[model samples]
Target: MSDLIPGLPEEVARECLVRVGFDQLPVVRRISRQWKWEVESPYYSRLRKAEGLARPMVALVQAQPTADDAGPAVHKGSSAAAATGGPANFYRMVLLDPAEGRWTALPTLPGPMESIPLFCHVAAADGGGRKRLVVVGGWNPETWAPMNSVYVYDFLTGAWRLGEPMPGPRRSFFACAAVGGTVYVAGGHDEEKNALRSALAYDPEADAWTALPDMAEERDEPRGLCVGDRFLVVGGYPTQAQGRFVGSAEAFDPAASAWGPEREEGLVPDGASPRTCCVVPGTERAYMLHDGHLVARDGAEASAWRTVAQVPEDARAATTVSALPDGRVVVIGSACHGGEQTVYVLREEAGKGGAVWARAPAPPEFSGHVAASLFLEI
Candidate 1:
């Protein structure tokens, strides 16, 4: 490769080949030989796609720094610190680097329960180089209650397996994305009561559970997305009517199993009370943070809903919004008032009335637990 691109320094080999991922950077260019032709050059692959650097800003598996190297430290604790008790308050397996805002915390989940609230949906594996990370399902304290048990978590083995489960008993659901390997659980509110249109899928390589074709509009905290392969469900409030947030919208097409017409299309932008969303994988745009604003949709063809940014009025009934692969958009640990909780991060600078809202850096521990955020690549 022309003597490894004439001796290195192409923006530090394109940020170490986009943090070591271009099918594993030729084993770090075999120890030397001018970093294996400046990371198998092509001008470091067009300066790694004009600096969009494809993927991997985080992929976590740390915990080897000893001799006071400051290893295990991500204690921004407080999801009410496990109610200030004597044991149960755990955390480890972290990777929050919104372009270096920092928090690494990995190593520990060999299972005895030292951490498990990174709440489901953290998949990535299709030549994108392996990733799973699924935990935080319900009950199961030794089968004392509700739990369709699922605990995959294996970013190439800091391990923990046992996938496939979820034909029933899920815990407050509404996740949307993860096509081929399955996982598209939407609309849930069961303890044996209301809300649940039953649209399941969890096929981690056929460990199995498949029962799609449901949603005719029976949302609980509705708001799902998968754009390209189709499965866009919006708005919630199954029933508990006071005016239950239901502007409606549906579209599920797993290659024509059918499900497409439920359009009420109501309040989606600052109309107040629909809150709860997640989806930014490969993008067509979709963000709906409820009430204080952050409603956007670009699915197109008469699909209008905008307010782009204005969060932090304590996030009005906050239901947790997270979509960070660096394009930034986050809201964590909801539910405020006395048992306080808040975490926001959305900044689009290039100033003069663009996109702004920043408060992130205040989770010394959360209260009223429930915080979800995923984008692991490294």
Candidate 2:
């Protein structure tokens, strides 16, 4: 009652508090133990209501080739090699806010597992009362070898918990999607033997692994982008190393039983591995980072390759790309060069000069083996 709770109206205060993030609930709980029940009771109900208004928009997180980031020797080679395995140097994880160009040093992996932080995928999800950014996969740089480790840290908690490892080695491999609370990891170079196309999913709640159907193609550093409900597995290297890039594209429908087909639409060069791709959720069109240019893929008709932007020739090898919520594409990192490069945000422009690229700011020192940014919904 209002009288019993002093100045607060029980029903009104509870609903208002529920709408705020969970991290704020504790402060309110300290008001009184009895008020805690009212605030926490409708948390889920409020979540359901809030989901209605929440739009699935992407935001740029961090970029590669950060100031303190290792070096080029680590991220050099085929995108597959750069992704599916570890660098031959010391492994480290550096957290940076791409928008702010800020940096945070994280504790290294436990024990003597020497490896590089080779493939990184971050996802944004709603966690009870707060938003969470979940970073998955890549190897422990200390081991300097392929690692099956999955570590997740909540910016809210500042605490790290080891998630379930992939079904197979996910080092130097590319492609990760955060659907619901589960993170899907597909394809990567497995130096344990050869390149792999195994698909695995990690459930954050249970901290467990579920083996999904293996991709139709044996791919490494292949691009994984979401189109509608299906996860699109695009171009990457095959088992053989003849610089063969797969032209075929396959779609994985979790609702269905198997992979669809290896089609020409949304396909890359037969031997040119696509390091990254972006899909404007709810649309059929997609974009791929090929060589040093951004290529567009249209699924309905035949997927055609069109260059959108260009980067420095020498920096093509280790560049990472992602799509922003505004439809502008953000590309970062340099492949061959040794110095720190600027993170470019590309907006569509008329004529044939190329998309207008504006350097937002310099990203933190990223580099090393796994140098890419994952979009989180924060």
Candidate 3:
């Protein structure tokens, strides 16, 4: 290989290859079989991470008005309108690199569907240097029917591949999280709109899903978060609630293969919506956007929700909240329904008494309102 690349030694060539940005991998992979193999290997991915060349990126399932559908116009109402038959819009993944202020689109999912699924969840895992983005189940774009599809996108290969269909009945709006290289899904609604208690875990390397013990109670559209090694499922409506969410919560211990006791209330405050909650990566704490304020809870303590900061007044409801490695939190939302979107970063000043929220440069397209979002360090 060193000889093929001329004067460069194999070690130098490897270093050079590992530094290639993920966006350019597809073009570089076409150069030759040797180059393709080198880029696709797990070792190369690890090399990139080890060399501190990997970038942090945020992936979101966003909505934008469909080009042809001009239907009746409505001001900003709820982000849910995008999927629930609001003005004709399409949902797709959009990638943003805060450090570089760059936005790019991954290839459209490999399917014949005209629009992406509604209510799908996305989770990413670090595969050596190559990162994998896994998109889980949601409703059919055209028929509003439940689906069991699973899609995985590999940064190294720059393409999307289908994963095994979710086991059992198709469920949508479930709680999902990526932990220890595996993705765990629990609680959601079945095709008949019945809340579900079953749960499962997926291993991307093996391309298989194994059954986990069922949750203690049926939950629909629950919020899923990874706290330390445990997967916590909180809030969600019961089949009878018919869209009225409860504050009960439970945690699944993979090692014990069982769900711990359920806190009937407090995990999520009464009247606090679960759709606005997210766990800051690496922080055993979960945050929720409630009444224009950011609230947090320590995973070890039950019902310890505390006010963290007030969200920008313009951000009516936090559609998504993500935390950077440095403990800074990024919130995306609009001031009013159908208002211009904005990105706010909450960071602590070294000598300042408390953290402050400041506006961050964001592309206008992101303002369309985020339906779902996740952060992954490349």
Candidate 4:
């Protein structure tokens, strides 16, 4: 045990090791075999959380701070790029540690792809004790055509690698979510611009995708969520009825390997987009930005939604409402269309006066447009 860290008591060494930030872990693991095993042990991360040392990090697909790697301002391009019309701005992935006000830029997307697709969706899930994030399907930046690409990022290795792309028939604006280490995607438009009802699940561990049964109806640009163990595909317009949302939601039961018959209605207002929505971690209940408020959907089967808190006014426009693993909701966006992007975190368990939104200071480099954002605790 003394070998764990030259001459130090094992328990004291462990306490020092557990306090190391996630970004510094890859280096720490290389110090020695004993140190590697000690940090990678299942209990290492658990101890960090129990001791309040685990930091909640947010990964964002945002506009580049400089003129480098910009893309055209098109239908599916980043809001930041379109807002600042002088030049096409390329989107890159960045990680932010709000507690420390630190930002880390991830390696650029692989191959000829210069930036993340304009509308590609991102989902985070646990993979063998390491935090994993996946980015899937959006219009290719180079060609402006739908792409079937899949890219996975591992926090432990601090690298990006390509995964198996979605099976044929590339789609766009699909709803996606991760539940129990599996990523699910459904209800988006096909290569022919036709809406689709098909669904599929991807196992990051196996680097494979398996098709699920079709939904009761075809939907385009729907919002996907996980409530408890169910995958909820909600509020998208059918193929021929573009821009006219159906205002209902359906659930996929993974255990039964089938979608249930019932669908809850009033999930969204007619003709409105449901892009700003996310599920609360652990509880698996839905939360979203609705009518200037942050609200949580009642449960897996009900249409009821209760107001959680008012979204900060600056972030009310063009918002990506995601709930952190710590049960805080971080709203990322600007005051109005084309405004500087900022972050506001809502503490769900605040002492009184209802939960309040505390604005996290964002540096200019991290303030470009946000295409999508997801939370991870490591």
Best by lDDT: 4
- The predictions' CA RMSDs to the true structure, in order, are 21.1, 7.1, 4.8, 4.7
Q: Model 2: residues >4 Å from true position, as ranges?
A: 1-116, 120-132, 169-174, 298-302, 312-318, 349-354, 363-370
Q: Which runs of model 3 end up more than 4 angstroms from their true locations?
A: 1-4, 65-87, 127-129, 262-265, 364-366
lDDT, model 3, position 368: 61
**Predicted structure 3: lDDT:** 0.76
Q: Rate the local accuracy (lDDT) of all candidates.
A: 0.54, 0.58, 0.76, 0.78
What TM-score does model 4 achieve against the real structure? Answer: 0.86
Per-residue lDDT tens digits of candidate 2, residues 1-378?
Answer: 333255766655555554654334446656765665554443543553566522233333322332236454333322333554533444444443445555454444443442225456665544444445556665544344555666665533445567666665546666777655556778777666477778876767667888888887787777777666777777777778635776677778878846887575436767676666666555666676766677776554554777776765534654556665556666666545654554666777645555776665533344333355555443
TM-score of 1: 0.28
lDDT of 2 at 100: 51
Tell me how many clashing residue pairs each candidate has.
Answer: 15, 31, 6, 2
Candidate 4 segments exceeding 4 Å error: 9-12, 67-87, 261-263, 301-303, 308-312, 325-327, 348-355
> Candidate 3 clashing pairs?
45-129, 46-129, 76-337, 76-338, 314-334, 314-335
lDDT per residue as tens, model 1, 144-163: 35456666654433456767
lDDT of 4 by residue, 1-378 (tens): 346777888888888898887888888888888888877777887788899887888889887754342233222234444566532547788888866668877877676555777789888877556677899988766557888999998776677889999995899989898876899999899988899999999988899999999988888989988777778888888888988987777889999988864444557667667888777766756788778888887455555778888767778784687777667777887889888788887887645547867888876556678888877777
lDDT per residue, candidate 3, 257-342, as tens digits?
88985565457776556876777677776777777788777664644777777787876556788876666777888877676677
Candidate that beats the other on TM-score, 1 or 3, i.e. the better one: 3
